[model samples]
Target: MRTAICSGSFDPITLGHLDVIRRAAACFDKVWVCVSPNAEKKNQLFTPEQKLRLVQAAVADLPNVEAELFPGLLADYAVDHGANVIVRGVRNATDFDVEYQMAIINRGIHPQLETMLLPASAEYQHFSSSMVREMIRYHQPLEKYLPASIIPLVRDMTERKGE
Candidate 1:
């Protein structure tokens, strides 16, 4: 099977993330949406459990996609899952540069695994978890950026979490 791992912080899975995951599902026999913590993001909006739940809810419709909380090196997770590809989404030049560098580093760590960068669809190119979190903080509508399945969950959770 051509298994791939789509690793990301996914503090809150957005429409753009769902888009890339949907596409990745079409290409890989199996795709695991690995929810890893972002070391750079010290104050995450959602807890690890909440992030995993949101991701699971968002990707429920995709048969080949599954969400997991991976608290170790991505390369190690890939090996454990028997995944040979790392799927990523690139929205623009800046994103490409960063993802490309990370891809190189991941490749060095797991020589058997390769990274595949998928260009973000135009509608979701500008959407990001950070942007959605900011909007949610100010009580803004998120119908455009978040998956319909998780919109209500996000609102409820954010409110309960005191955001």
Candidate 2:
């Protein structure tokens, strides 16, 4: 079975991420939407558990894809899960650059695995997790960027934008 891992902090999965997952699912036999924790990052709007749950709910419609929390190196996780591909969403040149470097590092660890970059559709090409967090802080509408099911779950983060 051909399997792929879509690794990300997914602090809050966005519609763009969902779009990538959808595309990945169509190509791979199985896709894991992993909410990988990052130790270098200290401030996160959602915990790994919360992110995993949100991802699970948001992607429930996809039968071949599953949401999970992975706490170690992505190559190791891929090996453990028998995944042969790492699917990533490249929204812009910046993302491509970062993911490209990561792709090199991950392949160094597991030479058999490959990284597949799926460029985000035009509508989602301009957004990022940090940008979404900023939008939440400024009380901006999230309907255009995030999965519809995610808004209610993140009310505590976005609803109290001011005062």
Candidate 3:
């Protein structure tokens, strides 16, 4: 099977992230939507488990996609899961610059793995987890950025966190 791992901090899964996963699912036999911890990011809005649940809810309609929480190196996770590709969503040059470096590093770590960068669809290009978090903090409407299935859950989580 051609398996691909689509991973990110996913503090809360945004529409852009879901778009990439859905596209990846059409190309790969299976796609793992992994919720991982980003060492570079601080003050996460949701726990890894909460992120996983949000991811799961967002992608429930995709039969070939599975949501998981992996706190280890993505390269190692890909190797263990028999995934030969790591899929990333790139919205602009900045995203490409970072993903490009990560892809090269990931290649060095797992020689067999390839990185597939999918440009975000125009409608969701401006949507991101950080942007969503900011909106949530201000109690703004999230219907434009998050999946319908997970908006309520995201609201509940943010409310519980007293955001």
Which pairs of residues collide in candidate 1? none
Minimal lDDT window, size 10, model 1: 36-45
Q: How many clashing pairs per prediction, in order? A: 0, 0, 0
**All predictions: root-mean-square deviation over Cα?**
0.9, 2.0, 0.9
Q: Residue 3 of model 3: what lDDT?
A: 97
**TM-scores of all models?**
0.96, 0.92, 0.97
lDDT, model 2: 0.86
Report the lDDT tens digits of candidate 2 across residue range 1-163.
9999998998778999999999999998999888898887765777788889889988999999998898889999998899989999997888899999999999999999899999999999988887887776677888998899888877764445331
- Which residue runs of candidate 2 sit more than 4 Å off their true CA positions? 156-163
* Candidate 1 TM-score, true structure as reference: 0.96
Off by over 4 Å in 3: none
Q: Could you tell me how far off, in angstroms, the CA of residue 3 lies in candidate 2 after the best superposition?
A: 0.5
Local error of candidate 1 at 62, Å?
Answer: 1.0
Q: lDDT for every model?
A: 0.91, 0.86, 0.91
